[model samples]
Target chain A: MRRSERLVAMTDYFKENPYTHISLPFFVKWFGAAKSSISEDLDIIDAMFEQLGIGRLQTSAGAAGGVRYIPDYDMELSKEKIDEIIELLEDPQRILPGGYVYMSDLLGDLKQLRIIGKMFGAAFKAYDVDYVVTVATKGIPLAYAVADVLRVPVVIIRRDPKVTEGSTVSINYVSGSSRKIQTMVLSKRSIKENSNVILLDDFMKAGGTIHGMVSLMNEFNATVKGIGVLAEAEDDEEDRRVDDYISLLKFQEVNEREGRIQVARGNYFE
Target chain B: MRRSERLVAMTDYFKENPYTHISLPFFVKWFGAAKSSISEDLDIIDAMFEQLGIGRLQTSAGAAGGVRYIPDYDMELSKEKIDEIIELLEDPQRILPGGYVYMSDLLGDLKQLRIIGKMFGAAFKAYDVDYVVTVATKGIPLAYAVADVLRVPVVIIRRDPKVTEGSTVSINYVSGSSRKIQTMVLSKRSIKENSNVILLDDFMKAGGTIHGMVSLMNEFNATVKGIGVLAEAEDDEEDRRVDDYISLLKFQEVNEREGRIQVARGNYFE
Candidate 1:
């Protein structure tokens, strides 16, 4: 009704429905405001969003023109978040048996996942991602988080097939770490043909899983527009199968005997 | 910043960090605004949130007092969303072989998941929930969605234990439909003892998986505060293992031969 009220309501709507086009008439009718008032409201929200380092409301000019919220995080803010995550990963208590660092805690944290997802979303924001794809279990949350920011659906590839999935496309690939053949399955109806996809994973070692995903994308005639991982572990240069991708954190070492760990910002910063 | 700018930034902050208390001074320092101005800005946002039927900002009094956003959806609005979902589920094309419904499209949708998660969050808002728990794969997104709204972490139970999980606690339980014994494994450090949790799932048939989750929660001495499912199929009254839970959709019938599907709002409305 009022200017302040309209600002709050419009801000919430834009946040909830990012990348969704809302016509001036739609807002005018919804809020019982004039078209000019709606336009002014958009400008204010857009300016504040930029000032807050979130993103901007992209308004196109034409008969089909409307405003859409393009979510983003400032590069500086993203770097700060990555530094915070690196500090968390460096904790010695996170060292597990063998050489694996315990990151399930961070993975399970919604706050951390949001930060990681937004960073990945920012990294891959240039690509036209139809669906955020990831293998099941740990990668599901990360995939959804990125998809949420991109305003796209998340297509999860499962390790084992299930009845509810209906018809599926299954692929077998070697595990990067264990070099054992493993299976990844997706429902045939999950993605449209010739669509663009962004592949995401929680962790990457030899990049086998990501490589497998790229191959699977080929099966559906979909393009692998981007690849992003939350953390990448050190592996031999020759053993690393996938070369091009973005990562937020790097795991340098994990000494189980001494309960020590080393981590740093991923190549995205570099 | 001015009132309008502060309104936009403060609204974004409240939406991002729900259920987390922020002292009035924090806003003062962050926005470079006077205490009175910050209070007025908060009042404007709080009033608009209620007017929008999203939720209210609860402000406490005294030295330990501040504001926290408690998100909620209007019951009438939630019903409209449910009806829309019912229409989508009722499409005949969703019928698969073996009388199964193809819902991966809906499950993959971030918009649908957010609405469903908010409904579940509102249902369990009265309870003191420390975590949102679900089994791996399809339920992971729903778990994260609900956890995001509740401002808590998610703990996923794997179908099989992994070496990366460190020490795990596992239990064998019978599958609700197939009557086959299955195992669910969780990291020992996932859930703190005596914590409260809300169980979530994509679908439920005989509730065996949920039943198993309840058993596992007992091992950790945790409380199952609430159980929410996206959909539940019709099961024999005697076959239903778990009785106390909330579901958004109910699958009444699926005739694969005729490509017919029947769906309706779940018991939450009833």
Candidate 2:
């Protein structure tokens, strides 16, 4: 293949696989091109990704290293995205009964999820996340979004044991929103030992679920990379677990007459 | 900016907003180059996307013409990805209650979702899809994945209405698994009239919920662009409303006692 053709193929491959490493020799063999040619092609693709701040192309020297695409996001881009999310949350249309925001739309929105994922990914990118973790139901989207950008797998801890998962490792954690003792379980095989995990959820109140995830990680001999929430209530300041976390938007207050929302500062977006 | 820098910038711009249009004048102004030079740059980018089969750079000529990048995936790539998913599902550990395979891992897997998104995007590339639609719960991830690659907004129909979403338009449909009445709803403002929608979900049993989406789309005067499911069971030889659809795997049967999974031919590795 020609240099132009090879460049395109490499980018496409990286985008689909994310967080994967590729050696120059593989491309050199696939394209019947010189090592120098593949190197030059990567230079172009790497520069493109870096300038965009959406992904990173890292070149490893020596024998084992070739090129690894690190999926990431720009802080400015993240800020703009979160600002839009906060605006959406504050919309009178989103307010629902019992003070819950009808967030199913935001959760279902691909664009909004992408922004949230990127924000979460950006926050945890530096921490070496192996899996994006979330408890059953609503947290699935948040976990999936982060996993997509990070190019890592996601581990879902179910609210109840289903026969489909066979044997599982269960953890009893307090619910952040409901403040009830809930049991979350993972199929023992779903997670690998010594993996780095980033915990995420759609909404966070007391963060008891996140603490459960932390404990689950401990059970698996894994590491807790970071924590992220799509919406965090600022009023419940006493129950948070880790200070090192990011929230795309903060739900400041809710009343019969008015509600307040604001985007929090984070590493993903300036 | 230099040609090299301009090339990098344009590529990055396209990647961040994967499937969107950019006028020639936009590039011409950004690069301080002639229309012809911009055309050449675009050609290079298009060829790269084509060679990789991961993106499309389309050009329109006329008073209102410009270029748009539509990210896409090849059928062969989709097939390979499906095979991988089946392999994972085959792990015996995934078998859950009610013949539902534990899909939390696959749903949470970012790299897999990206491939799934790009492939689904390719299938609907020719369709005039406006918003992605799905019922609440499992459909959330499907909507998120499709929305990511299609660069379109997603509207989620709730199984149960919550206070946050305000007033909703409800639909009653049959569910695949139970063949029972299920309710799905959409906020009045969520989907626009005359919009073109693509329906997606993670699993298809009887495909009753999809029918509800179709009805809801009708209420909005919108068109059904396409329908897609991540996995479909073979025993569902029932009435079909979807004219075009794709699935990664076709489950032949699940023998719980033997801990065996039977999967038949799927388009993904074909």
Candidate 3:
């Protein structure tokens, strides 16, 4: 392959496989090129990703070291994305019955989820997350999106035991938002012990779900390194079960009768 | 920018934004290059994607023509993935109580999901999919995977109405596997009218969930261009509700007491 073609192939490989290490020999063997040429190609790709504030490629100079792709979005890019999310949340037409903003469209949106996922991934990328955890239903996509970029598996907690998942470890907790006692289950084998986990969800209200996830992670002997939500509702501020987390968008108020919404940037930027 | 560097940026851009068109002038403006030069860079990318089974770049002729990227995996690569999945599924350790295999690990696995997502993306690339659809829960990951590859949005159906989603269109359908009547809801604005949708899920046992999704799509007057599942259970062959679909892995049988499993390639190849 030509030098131009090699760069394209190299970028694709690294982007597809983030947080993965590939030896220089692998590239050397694949391209049938000298070590120097491979290094030049890496520098070019690394510079491009760095310049754009997307991520970076790192080289290990030792015998076993190759290159690893670390995807991250800088502070400025993150702020822009959150601002856009807040704008989307403030759409009056999105105000549903009660105080809920229509998040399914945002959750279901491919582009929207991608941005959210990337932002969350960027936030937790430094945590060395071994698994991305979330409860079943809405949070699954957000969890998967984070796991996708981090190149880690996602452990989806279920409200009910699934027949298809085999044996599971079940736990009971009071939902922070609903204030209802709920039973959630995880496959006994879903996560390995001592793994580092990042908990993510689409919405946070009183943080019953996020609190439940943190407790569940304890059962696996895994550490909850970070917590993130696509949007956090400030309704239950006094009743919130968990503190010390990041939210992309803050829902200050949603008036169904008035057809008004007050939204702002989340703690992620702060 | 030089041709080599421009090729890297263009490849990354198209890879990130598949199934979307970019005009020549847009590239010229971004890269500070001439139309002819931009065309040459696109050709370089088009060749790389074609030579590899991963994706393809197309050149549109005439006034409105620019370039579009379509990502797909080759036959050899697809086979390797399915074969690996079959091997993984065949493990007796995966057999769960009540004949359920422990797939949370596989489903939650980042590497595994990426492969499945890319393969599914390739299979349905020709569908001109407007949106990727799936019922909430386990199938969400599979749905997002396909959507990411196609550069389209994902429409997730909720098992129950969510206040945060505003008004929803709920439908009652009998789950093919459970044979129980259930209600699944979707936000009114989740999917646009007359959309070409591809329905995906993690497992298909009688495809009750998939059937529900297909029915839900009808409510929106959307077309079910294709149906893809990560795995399909052969247990309910006689009473299966839907027949026309694609599956990557086939679950031949699972013996709960004996701790045995049987898996094979799905109908995708056939």
Q: What TM-score does the predicted chain A of each candidate obtain versus native chain A? A: 0.97, 0.90, 0.97
lDDT of each: 0.90, 0.74, 0.84
- For each candidate in turn, give its C-alpha RMSD to the true structure in angstroms: 1.1, 3.5, 1.7
Cα error of candidate 2 at position A177, Å: 5.3
Total clashes, candidate 1? 0
- Model 1 lDDT tens row, B1-270: 788888888899999999899999999899898988988888999899998888999999898878999999889999999999999999998887788888888878999989988998889888979999999877898899899999899999999999888899999999988999999999999999999999999989999999999999999999999999899997543689999999898888888887888888999998
lDDT (10s digit) by residue, model 2, range B1-270: 555556666765677676667788988887789999888878888887776666678889998999888878877766676777777778765666555677766766666676777777887888878888877566677777888778787777776775556777887877656678878777887877888889898877666767778887888888987888877777774665553577767888887677888775454444
Tens digits of per-residue lDDT for model 2, A157-239: 87777665667899887777677888888888788889988888877777777778788889999888677877777777686
Error of 2 at B65 (Å): 2.0
| lDDT of each residue in A137-158, candidate 1, tens digit only | 8888899889989989999898
Models sorted by lDDT, best on top: 1, 3, 2
Identify the leading candidate in terms of DockQ: 1
User: Could you estimate the TM-score for every candidate?
Assistant: 0.98, 0.86, 0.96
Which candidate model has the greater DockQ, 1 or 3? 1
Error of 3 at B232 (Å): 1.8
lDDT of 2: 0.74
Give the top-scoring candidate (TM-score).
1
From the highest DockQ down, the ranking of the candidates is 1, 3, 2
